[model samples]
Target: MIHKLKKRRGIPAGPLRVIGSRAQRPGPAVETLEIVLKCDSFGTVEAVTTLLGKIGGREVEIKVIHSGVGDVTKNDILMALTGSRLVAGFNVGLAPRLEQWTKEHGVEVRLYNIVYTLAEDLGALARSLIQTEPEERILGRAKVIATFKSSRGSIIAGCEVLDGVLAHGRNFRVVKAMGPVFTSRIESLQVEKRPVREVRAGQQAGLKVTGFVDVRVGDYIECFDPPVGRRSSAWSPRGAVLRFDENA
Candidate 1:
């Protein structure tokens, strides 16, 4: 049996209700660049479309929202506005008058007579769109064995490196039996009363922490750092929000 649909585009637009634009496909590690392609003929359209498909690598994706065999028209530019704001013409050109209109609309239109040049331009465009995301890696871990006040009145947790190396100026998370307490960057790390940059596994060191002082014995400390050249001075709590379970 067939049933009537409930909503289209948004909650059926009958009640003067206002809704935001529809969400496009989600972005991923490989960014997507949408384009409206117009060529002189269907054969050229198919050939260029196939070439564009294999142009981008895993970093960026080139998607053709619409392809047709004709000169660039207002409709094609409109489609580009809703997509990547780009239009490519192969062996075709936009009407002379539409040039000004396209610029005012903030849409880009590229006309190419040579297929090789077109492919080269598109390939470079894809590379330009590649976005490099910050990468994170755990530097080391340790367990708090004691706590004491430093000469500067800052609280220092005496920790024993349990598995990995712990480095100063790296972000850290203090976790207890209950859950994670807080996170901050390690301001100071030392061994035998001397300041040190890092401590390897099986080594005992004093770690000075700012913005938090409640570290307790038996608490685990996780130290992490972003890739080199990436900003590491700021810290964000990766642990889930703390909630007490009455049943537990």
Candidate 2:
């Protein structure tokens, strides 16, 4: 998720009283003070919430205007700040359509090119975006996935690699009606555990995920790769990588 601070000019400053005295001291004229939390996935909401809480503890008044997945539309931006006495600025993904919309609306919206899977960079970006106060805290977004396999109760899963890479020996989630039912690791990966490095989109593979029982067919397995120490290397078996969707 991306957090941003927006300020505007030309609004009346509210009443303020000087400390330990009856005289009135002028508060900084705040024609506009709006904060926006933007993200491309629902999972980012938690991280954004935590960041806001930390900022608030330091006396920054921030309200979440909108939080959801998908591209940020002009309507979403307008709705988020509508009826407020102050104008708002925006920080969103670098999408051309969004940029055009911002230009038409005449609101200054900053675009950030966030590299996926890097937690430290994301945290730093969030901090830089907020100018009111500074805090030394590190926060990151978590990765999640769902696994599907046979009904034999073994770790052999015929799964689709969505969003991010699913590698051998990595921890994953077995989604059930009661939320995440179990946490397991990929014991082995194969076109069937024949020793593969990574799996990508559009290719079905058998994964021997460990630590879960009753892993029925069609059950989803979710996995998370923390945003630390993630390598930028390409997945091997170059030909296999090509088979996956470039957009995935």
Candidate 3:
């Protein structure tokens, strides 16, 4: 659970006031956040609620203010203002002049485009309040062979896996002659025109990266496993070793 500040319109911003009073002490644990939710489509609302349920479990609470047709009404804003809670909207928008009203009332309003991002934001807040430690592990390394443009206009790198394995969805860092230059996740991977989950050592594959686009030949790409938080542990390989015959 996360704690959100409650603000009164006339009061000056100072120390946090718990449950609408300046004298009350904060709770030992942030019980739960009551969020006013609005979404443009019923499907999106359902998806967001499902994801939030999965992520927050029983630690969060949501009140759907508007779903499927309407924009956030003044009543919704008034509800949040009087209740001293947050308002989250997906694809739906706030009515004109509501932004200023929220500011005046000191209510927080968050807007999101993607459902995953919306859930991620709230989940991150909760995790932060709980304090989670994440560990990182390297997975593989590949040498860039060539660069090309995909039909969708994304830059693709033709690479040969030199060590371990390069898998789809793995985080990667691009290293040039000087030093490491860029870092991001692999968007797509293909082996000989066929999509593949992974490319093992000594195999060549095409890689589409998400953020860092300026990839060139001879650059090194290092793949790493997703960082795991202390609360959730998942199996990950340590390393793969290859030895060449000395006589050869």
Among all candidates shown, the one with the greatest lDDT = 1
**Considering TM-score, where higher is better, how would the candidates rank from best to worst?**
1, 3, 2
Tens digits of per-residue lDDT, candidate 3, 10-73, equal: 3323221222211222444332444556677666666776666556433333333333334555
Clash counts for the predictions, in order: 0, 6, 0
lDDT (10s digit) by residue, model 2, range 1-248? 11122214422122111112112225642222233444544455546545543442232233444444444555444543442211122223433465555445544443233323223322333343333432322111122233455456664667765545666666667665667687656677676546786676655567775556556655666656534543333111111001111244
Superposing all C-alpha atoms, what RMSD in Å does each candidate have to the true structure? 15.7, 21.3, 21.0
Worst 10 residues of 2 by lDDT: 235-244
Whichever of 1 and 3 has more TM-score, that candidate is: 1
Candidate 2: clashing pairs of residues = 145-222, 146-221, 147-220, 147-221, 173-222, 190-193
Model 1, position 202: C-alpha lDDT score: 98
Residue 202 lDDT (model 2): 55
**Alpha carbon RMSD to native, model 2:** 21.3
TM-score of candidate 1 on Cα atoms, chains taken together: 0.51
Error of 3 at 45 (Å): 66
Q: Indicate the worst ten consecutive residues by lDDT in candidate 1.
A: 235-244
> So what's the TM-score on candidate 3?
0.37
Q: Give me the runs in candidate 1 sitting further than 4 Å from their true place.
A: 1-33, 43-83, 90-135, 149-154, 210-213, 226-248
